[model samples]
Target: MPRKPRTSNISRSDYYDITFYLQHYACFHCRKAFKQSFDNQRTQRLCPQCRQPMTNMGTDFKAPAQKEVAQWRKVQSLAQAGIKFFPQWPDGRPGERPDTLAEIPAFLKQVHPPSEGEQMLERRSQEPQRPQTPREGKLSLQGFAPHQTFRLSGKMLITGDGVQVFHNEGWVNAEVSGHGNNPKQPSHLRTFKLVGNKLYYAETVPLDGTLRLRWPAT
Candidate 1:
């Protein structure tokens, strides 16, 4: 008879270690979450806690800590079925459970009391401070500071000579010229208006002839 093939210890050890990682799964019947091995989980769909068939939520998620799990269990106990929350959660589609499982961390942070050190740090971070940069770099406007930046689109005229606009990490010298009696005139920059510290500028290419981009006046 032919000799039977032998299993290598190294391959068996690697397989055991790799398969030991926790996989996140949920049981719709019991409304519970659990961590289990792939082989056992495949064969036994029944939850150890509930002894009911579970819906595989996949292996990409981290299991919540014991404290968080206990706290969430309390919340689940109080939650009413079919009642929408103050802010209704976005649960992609029917049959696919809510992705709100990720929100547990934020919920925990909000409801749980922080240590004295954490409270002190949070308070200190909230205090306001003066602007560190000089006023020369910012654009001055009617309702904004000289250090603020605002976007310019449509016909605008910049009165100040040697006026530099911030672009691509460094300041670039800008020269404005008129559209020469055209019905649709180009945008002008009369004064710098800063809406917020950070702004996004995106250009859209539409099939129609007309081109338009708009920014808030306030």
Candidate 2:
């Protein structure tokens, strides 16, 4: 008889250890209740559809956790049978299942709070300040600091009465040289330039072509 081929054996403990490491790599942004070996680990950190980062979250995998997951699945199954998810939580005390995709941002934020740049923005927004009004019917450029970093991109149109009429941030106002109410419209109108900051200037662009000043008259 031909000699039987020797088979390499993998110990159950070894297999379990490998399983634990692959199944739970200290996830920081998402929980992995269950994963199958069929999933390729190399591309695990990105979504297959949108190519977005996938979060790995925290978990305490014990009997109580398993029970919670079981209860959640039971409720989710019931809801799939046309049960309303929120009206008193269609599946008794267990409640509804979260949409994994919808819950990603919350998970990531929890895992990784604001970085230094984002924290700086929060500080700037919270800085104490006062609102300013325009001067001399014409916007006095003196008080308003020029946006030096990025030059303003929009146009300025003055009202016939010498007022910089309507204003909006990052938009330009169209002019017909002097103020004559747009022929077809009840209110005089102007379209804004798509690029500049409108906040420093007194001009404005209404959605329907009419520009009105948002600043207090000087």
Candidate 3:
């Protein structure tokens, strides 16, 4: 006699982490609900409290009561609007239909009462659809140039040396070769990062006021 084919072994990469926080299962014997994880292979799922084998309730085991009602109402509305259900798939399971227009009132009644789904669907279908407004455009600084001068209140002060100074016909780098108040004058470069809507500099301006290079002609 031919031996049965060996069960396929899964690779580590093929097995993904399964988190079943919201999903639940019921014990086969006691029918008590319990949360379960399918991460590791188990010969039997014995409940911690009952020690009974548990059966999977599947992914769609539970849903919000409101959402279920809303969905069924939508289906009933479509059916009432002259829609007909299409043929089901060849291998489809029960309660799972390819096209559900024909299953309206019955399918809906299973989830809700006699007329709740129908009433909600009728009320929703008659309400006027609101038009959505376009969102406001955000200001992008793609072409924004860095501020060459630091302006406070109304007084404008030169940033520092090494800044572009307007010259006779073109721009030239300002003299920045001195330590203190000597021949070339005190000069230092300041760096800043833009956070949200403001530019924040790393270091504060020195207490010793540095010389402000005269602004050249435009």
TM-score, per-candidate, Cα-based: 0.21, 0.22, 0.21
Encode model 2's per-residue lDDT on 1-218: one tens digit a residue: 99999975864323434455333221212222332232334456554345455332212221124335544443333333333222132433323333443454454455457799988998999998654644322222212212111011132433322223344443233432222343212223344344464423334333222233333344
- The residue-by-residue lDDT of candidate 3 on 1-218, one tens digit each, is 99999985752212321442333454434535565566357456677677876544443333123335444444335334433232224643224422344566565555455577877898898999753532221211121123123322233333343333323444333433233443223334343445798865533332122323233322
RMSD of 2: 18.2
Against the reference, the lDDT scores of all candidates come to 0.41, 0.35, 0.41
Global local distance difference test of model 2: 0.35
**Given candidate 1, what's the lDDT at residue 123?**
90
Off-target runs (Cα >4 Å) in candidate 1 are 1-18, 62-218
